[model samples]
Target: MLKTTVLNTAHRALGARMVDFGGWEMPLHYGSQIEEHHAVRRDCGMFDVSHMCAVEALGPDVKTFLLRLIANDIGKLKTPGKALYSTLLNEAGGVVDDLIVYYLSDTHYRLVINAGSTDKDLAWMAERLCEWRLDVCLIPLRTGPTAVAMIAVQGPHAKARVWEVLPEVRPATEKPGPFFAVEVGPLCIATTGYTGEEGFELTVPAAQAEDIWNALLAAGVKPCGLGARDTLRLEAGMNLYGQDMDESVSPLDAGLAWTVDLASERDFVGKAALLEKGRQRQFLGLKLLTQGVLRAHQKVVTAQGEGDITSGSFSPTLGCSIAFARLPLGVAIGDRVKVEIRGKRLDAEVTRPLFVRHGKALI
Candidate 1:
C-alpha cells in the first residue's frame, strides 16, 4: 500500500488527480497543470509538501556531528533560523542526498529532506551517528504522533498571503530575509522555497494541516500539485534528487560545487574524493529551438562530445521546452547542440542552467 499524507482527503475533496509519486499517493494536479503553473508564476499558489520528511538533531554535539557529516560548512549557520543547502555524500564523493539544514542553535538543528530519500537517509544518518558515537540524537519529525505537515506558498505575493492567513506570524516572519526561518507559536515560517519566487514554507502540526489548507484556499491561493512543482523547480534550474543526480553523480559535475565547501580545512565525508577526481562534466540548460517537448535521457550531441539530458519539460513561464543536461566539459553558452528526440535530431541552444526566475525568463 502506498503512503498518504495527512492532507490526502483534502486533496481528493478538491478534485485532484492523484498519481503514485515514489511510494506516496500524491496529487499530480487539481484541474489544469499549466494553469497551476501560471498561478505560481503570475500570482500565488500553495503546494501540499507534507510528504517531505523533517528531522531534528539535538544535543550538545550537534554542530560537531554536522560539520563532518555534510559537504557545506555549517559554521556559517551562526544566526538562529538561517538555512543552508548541502549534500550528504558517501565515501566515493557521490551525492547521497541533497537536503536543507536549518540552524536553530548550537545544540539543535532541523533538516527537511526529499520524501523519497527519507528512509535511506535516516538509516544512513543512524549508522553514521553510531560510527561517530556522538551524543547527539536524530529525531524524525514527519512520523509518529508528533508529525508535522509542510505547505509551500510560492509566487510574488506568496509571503503576503501567508501573512494574511496567519496574522500573528507576520511580526516574526516579516523581518527575516531569504533563507531565514522563524519559529512563531505552533508555526515555523521559513522564507525559503523551491520555486524561483519569494515565498514562505509553513511547517505546522499535522492536526492543523487541513484547517491551514482550507484557510489558504479561502484566501485564494491556488492549490498546485507535484506536476507544477516539478516544472517550476526545473525552470528555476534546480536539481531534482534521483533525476538530476544520485549516488553515482558528484556535486561538482552536477553544478552544485558552490554547495560543497572544499576551501576550508574542515574535512567532510566526500572532500578527499572530490579533490582527487575533480569535476568531469559541465551541467547546463538546454532551450529547444524547434518543435518538440524535451524529456530526460535524450541524447545530446555537442562539439565537445555526447551528453544526456537529466531533466526536461515544457516551461510554461518561457513558453518553450527546457531541460538540464550533463554535457561534456568545454561546452559554452550560445553553443548550438542537437538533441535526439525520437529518430529526428532537434536543435537546441546551450545556456546557463537557469531558464526562468522570479516570473521572468533569463534565457
Candidate 2:
C-alpha cells in the first residue's frame, strides 16, 4: 500500500488528481495544471510537502561528523537555524543524495532528505558512523503520527499571503536572513524555497495542517499541486533527483559544483576521488529551437561527443522546451546540439539555466 499524507483527504476534497509518487500518494494537480502554475506566478499558492523526511542528528560531535559526511562546508553555517544545501557521496564520488541540513546548534542538527531515499540514507549514515568510530546519534523523526506537516507557499506575493493568513509568523520571519528559519508557535517558517520566487516553507503539526490549508485558501492562497511544483523548480534552475541526477552521477557533472566545498582542508567521504577524476564532463542547459518537447533520457548529439538529457520538458512559463544535459567537455554555451525526440533530430541551443524567475523569462 502507498503512504498518504495527513492532508490527503483535504487534497481529495479540493478535487486533486492523486497519483503514486515514490510510494506516496500525492496530488498531481487540482483541475487545470496551467492555471495553478499561473496562480503561483501571479499571486500565491501552497503545496503539501509533508512527504519530505526530516531527521535529527544528535551528539556532541555532530558538527565534526557532518563536515566529513557532506560535500558542503558545515562551518559556513555560523548562525542558529541557518541551512546548507549539499550532496552526500560515495567512495566513487557519485552522488548518494542531495539534502538540506540545518544547523540548530553545536550538538544538534536537522537534515531534510528526500522521502524516497529515507531508508537508504539512514543505512548509509549508520554505516559511515560505524566506519569513522564517531560518537553521534542519528534519529529519524516520524512524520505520520507525531511530526508536523510541511507546506510550501511560493510566488511573488507568497510571503505576503502567508503573513496575511498567519500574522504571527511574519514578525519572526520578516527580517529573516537568507536560508534561515524561525519558529512560531507550532510552525517553523523558512525563507527558502525551490521556486525562483519569494516564498516560505511552513512546517506545522499534522493535525493542524488541514486548518492551516483552509485558512490560507480563505486568505486567497491558491492550492497548487506537484505538476506546478516541477515546472517552477525546473524554471528556477534547481535540479530534481532521479531525473537530473542519481547514484551513478556526481555533483561535478550535474551543474552542482558550487555546492561542493573542496577548498576546505576537511576530508569528506568522496573528496579524494572527486579531486582526482573531476573536470572531465560538464553540465549545460538546452533551449529547443524546433517545435517539439524535450523529455528525460532523450539522446543529445554533439559534434564532439554524445550525451543524454537529464531533465527536460516543455516549460510552461517559457512556452518553450528546455532541458539540462550532461555533455562532453567541449560542449560550450552558444553551441547548437541535436536532440533525438521521436527518432528525429531537433535543433537546440546550449545556454545557462535559470530560464524563468519572478514571473519573468530570463532566457
Clashing pairs in 1: none
| Residue 111 displacement (Å), model 1 | 0.7
- Tens-digit per-residue lDDT, 1-363, candidate 2: 999988999999999999999999999999988888888888888899988887889998888899999999988888888998999999888888999999889998988899788889999999989988888998775644657788999988998888888998778888886688877777888877887888998888888889999999999988999898888888889999878878888899998899999987889989999999886678888999989988889999999999989888888888899988889998889999999999899999998866888899888
| Top lDDT prediction, candidate number | 1
The list of candidate 2 runs beyond 4 A from truth reads 143-145
lDDT of 1 by residue, 1-363 (tens): 999999999999999999999899999999999999999999999999988998999998889999999899999998999999999999999999999999999999999999999999999988988999999988988777779999999999898898899999988887889899999888899988999988999999999999999999999999999999999999998999999999999999999999999998999998999999999999999999988999999999999999999999999888899999999999999999999999999999999999889999998
| Residue 276 local lDDT, model 2 | 92
- RMSD list, candidates in order: 0.7, 1.2
Candidate 2 displacement at residue 230 in angstroms? 0.9
Give the per-residue Cα lDDT of candidate 2 at 186: 74
